[model samples]
Target: MYPDYAKKPRNVRLGLCTNDFAPHGQYGRTYSCWPIIITPYNLPPSMCMSSKYMFLTMVIPGLSNPKHLIDVYLEPLIEELLQLWHHGRKACYFDWHRQFLPEHHPYRRNKKAFTKNRIENKVARPRLTGNQPLDRVANISLAVEMPLSLPDGYSSDHKWTKKTIFWDLSYWSTLLIQHNLDVMHIEKNVFDSIFNTIMDIKGKIKDNMNAHRNLKIIWNRPELELDERRPNIMPKVVYTLVKEQKRRVCEWIRGLKFPDGYASNLPRCVDMTELRMHGMKSHDWHVFMQKLIQIAFREMLPEHVWSALTKVSLLLQRICSTTVDVHKFHELENSVSIIMCNLEKIFPPAFIDSIEHLIVHLSYEARVGGPV
Candidate 1:
């Protein structure tokens, strides 16, 4: 890693002691001496008793010119095929051909730019008579070619630029070398079950909110009740995911299910004005928030889930509703909102306000939408 890319390994290790000429009465034998430079493969003199001569294997530059690299790496597979063919096993050869042949092989004709060998030089080129460094002109050229120079819109974000370069590199690499890593094969069964479940729900559920809300039901509902046409590779795995989804969905849905214009903790259907006058006196809003949260977690929630959520509300209030300082609160708000939105779809309109208002005040400093 420490070696410079420009330095050739052989030149660095051994230098020419003499040029093509020798003095009179002397044999012109140019001796090459090894330097004290030590690599991982190099052994020290103390480690071995015998004097040794080191030979460096030269890596021809064009061998890694993308095309040759692919051939060298796949040499084992080619050797196996040659051995099979030499044995006069025509059927084995045919099977090997069918097995290893790629459907979209790019090697039939080397038309791609990557297959062609080209010199990549890091040397400086004369562009203009200038006092400025080479980088300045390069930057100016880059800016001139940018999309913003035209009338059409230009995205100047660095992230998009990096993504485009990465994708192009990946495409070229895939063409040169088939990435044989079976990514989907590793998780194929689970992936297939999830994919099938999503396809099943895609058209059947009318609303996206409903589909999102019923993610658990879509996966975990007893196999006996699921549509037979829908394929499920692992019902048990699907069932486990469904249960987890249900719990998460229910948390957010609770807030949106709260009733509107219903007097909170009020006695005997009192008038709005009377309830407001008395409600503020008796109810501590923070305490009331605690009770509502506790009611949702009737069976006592873990410190991480419940306490983490409550602390988020406090942080949100303390930070004046800015998400930068309260990333966790933002996460909690989003998670809770998904559940609440789903619950709102099924809940009666009259019952949504009280619960929704409480969650809103906890997560955000903004006042409730309507009058107090």
Candidate 2:
């Protein structure tokens, strides 16, 4: 439960906000409402007394830093709090940074330096003469001139400032303490990157051939044998078969009926001729790779290729479940670790690190009921 001041109707105002384009062909629309009174008092007795928290205050669109829209959203709320009987000077920004950098890391150290300079020289510095509240908020604007010098391998170039209204020192009492990492997004991204690597998509290292050869050697069964007697297929022929297979698969997917209780949103069927692998979510990718691929193109693909795909698919399928036991998650981690170690070329060290990081957290999250 929040403080008594937070529950006060006079001290709070709430609205659900969204941006939408005009029906014709216009863009850049703005809409706001302060009419909705969404305090706990308006809710039913049972709902109001529920443990779950809800704060439907103000919403600001766009990702720009110095747009003044965020300031507009918070300014009135701050004023109301200030006017309240139990006004508190202390405020905190809860920053969820997915690409987490540790305290000792150079990037984090650089951010700390930037934060310190902004706080001491700008935010905390006394103003000469102006509206005190406006001046206080203006001090919160952090300059983005300083470029982050990262380690050699990092791909990003210094193009934009990292300043946000959330980092405004004047509004928040504690700067560093407020910033935290969202483990869910981090895990999602890590899983996506790993999946991309295995599929050899999105510029990831393509060692599918090596994986195929390794799989052939490991699974030296007669059923998984390469037909040496058959003549080599032409490149054009292979391409045509692949294209046709994709079209058929797309048709099948559209016709397929999902059973009740499927957790993920049903993937929309797209015309493969018009859109090549468009409208697919992360879960769709997993499903396609794990179940659809082999079923759709069973006879067309080579034994080695099929075997390699199956191996990766099975491994990923085991770990990518919506609900995984702690023991299963641990087993998945160990299995992935072994695979990464055994097939260095197929699963590059950097790619493997992403998988490992997510796997390490998966068990903890499972124990806690869900991802954070």
Candidate 3:
């Protein structure tokens, strides 16, 4: 409908536009920009649509920041819209980003006060000081205007300057909406953290042996067994692979190939040498959680733990579905909340806090049918 809308003389009104940075690999060294354009709900049902139709207008690779995003990607898009408006073909004028500002003219002048506050504290943290608004673009723009020192490692040349594009109040006042939080990235991180906590994998504080012992106890319970048969062997302690085991596991992962007609987002595993040269991707981690762990550990992981892991995997899978709606997302959130409640004893508050923050936003995004 964008082409058709561009041809129409009526004012164009976009629903919401979301933006986020995505890492190219498991390591966070390199990132890419992703911007999505969503159609307004008021439009005909045929026009407002799915992720497939969501306009992904740019893919700026390397590294970027909010300012870079506004200047490089967003500003160009806005310029095109303004052109359409000037030519009497108004493509969109929703200005979702402006909804969050106070109901007053000349709100941009509030930057001076925030700058003064920053000057006084020297090391004071920066925060949004504007009135509550639906989109945070205004607040973030204001925050950028303050004379906060750049963080270490940022080149002085890259610091904000008087000529920065986002400083143009007229341009910012017409912003489409606040950038979205990438749900996939958030879910993947939360899932990894939860899985690592349970397995007592690298970076988690839990003791692997203790985790194994708890699982063993859970699996060995009298009520859990089938009649007259001893439970299958469970690991008494977490397995630490010797050099030979490491080589074998690496070999197996490298040898893996998807069968014909199997569709996967990630490609088949590369050799260890290639993996070392090129870092792992999020899909590699997904494969690790969904398949590799079971093969590597065999019967070491108890059935109950696998059941719990399955639940987490399924939740991630369900939310990514094109047919997922607000109710389904709410169900996912409730299911995760229950999982967290039951596992609270096993996981730390800090770990649980992180996951809760991501889960809590699902309902809002679901209702809006896009990232909020």
Candidate 4:
């Protein structure tokens, strides 16, 4: 690695990002395409993120994410980078573009990318910024699937997965801000969990038989524990909305209107009959979490529950603002922990996902890494 690379602004400083997206809506046949994009940090802020300048390095196509096996496809990219660093910079060492294509999809079969002639069956499966939930999840094997909380004997103890392929880059560890949490995405995940659980959307919310059974295993809230006499019936919880409340919340969102271009037509996202919101975009989630959340739930939930949710929303608004207040930032850094604990008491344990706990660390990152 060149020591002067940082001093020389012309040197390419790469930022790589990828996420699973369905080009043709979420329903019907399932399709996911992970677009691997690269951007040079040397460009001006205006052009840094411009699609014209960004490069689509690779596209991993399949029914689900590669998960741990992603490194196999990235080997070429790694070799190219290694050559550039160790053997001096040079472009176009190898022509391995087709390696990025999908080998076999759930809908159709195709030649394997790496082993060309070999036919392989489809492989399965599918962050917030800021903080780590030390007691993250129960012991789980990552190869099978993503870390899942066990309904029985669930433990918050931290469990880590294998190191990422990016670590193969020699200079990666030396970077001051090695990785930053994607705050916008974290906001959406948190909102989805909270909003869905509160509205009690079937199959979407975290509170269920698993969560109810989990209470008995953890031995925390005796009140929420499933009664031996009525194991089939779940006890009512404070965080959820009744049938009427869910109907009203959905109706309110359906009828509300916003100024042109200020936000999307959120009315369409609401399902009147189902009493739930669907198809909300990232920015729409941002608006709802940072602004509309408190007002929408003001009457639906209990005062204490509403107050806790409001604090969570307010924390996001403050953190996402154009500027961060030193005084408020410190207060936020300290206060998020208490708020998280309050939420733990109110919502089911299953509700405490990684993103939900990430609020505890946002203030720390904001202070250290500058404004988000």
Candidate 3 residue lDDT tens string, 70-109: 5554555565555445544212211111222233423223
What is residue 238's positional error in candidate 2, in angstroms?
10
Rank list by TM-score: 4, 3, 2, 1
Give the TM-score of each candidate: 0.17, 0.33, 0.38, 0.56
Output the worst ten-in-a-row residue range by lDDT, candidate 3.
Answer: 115-124
Prediction-by-prediction clash tally: 11, 0, 5, 3
lDDT on C-alpha atoms for all candidate structures: 0.29, 0.40, 0.44, 0.68
Per-residue CA lDDT of model 1 for 1-372, tens digit only, reads 635522322222221111122234344434222222112233344532223433322222221133434455344444433443343211111001111113333322222211122221222222222223232223332333443222211122211211122222434433322222221222222222222232223322122222223223322223223234544432232212243443443443333333554324333212222111122222323323333333433343434334433542343334333324455555544444433333232221221333233342333222111111
Tens digits of per-residue lDDT for model 4 on 1-372? 557665432246778888888867874557788888888876787897998778988888888888987887676667656645554432221112122224433212323212224333533211222212212322334345543222232222222443344444766655545577888899999999899888888878877765566455433566667888998888888778899988888888887888887789999898887888888899999999988999999998999999999999988888887887788888877677557656755676567766676666687678667777
Worst 10 residues of 4 by lDDT: 92-101
Give the Å error, residue 345, model 3: 3.3
Model 3 TM-score relative to the real fold: 0.38
Off by more than 4 A, model 2? 1-241, 260-268, 281-283, 286-294, 320-326, 340-372
- Positional deviation of 12 in candidate 3, in angstroms? 54
Strongest candidate by lDDT: 4
Candidate closest to the true structure, highest TM-score = 4
TM-score of model 4 relative to the true fold? 0.56
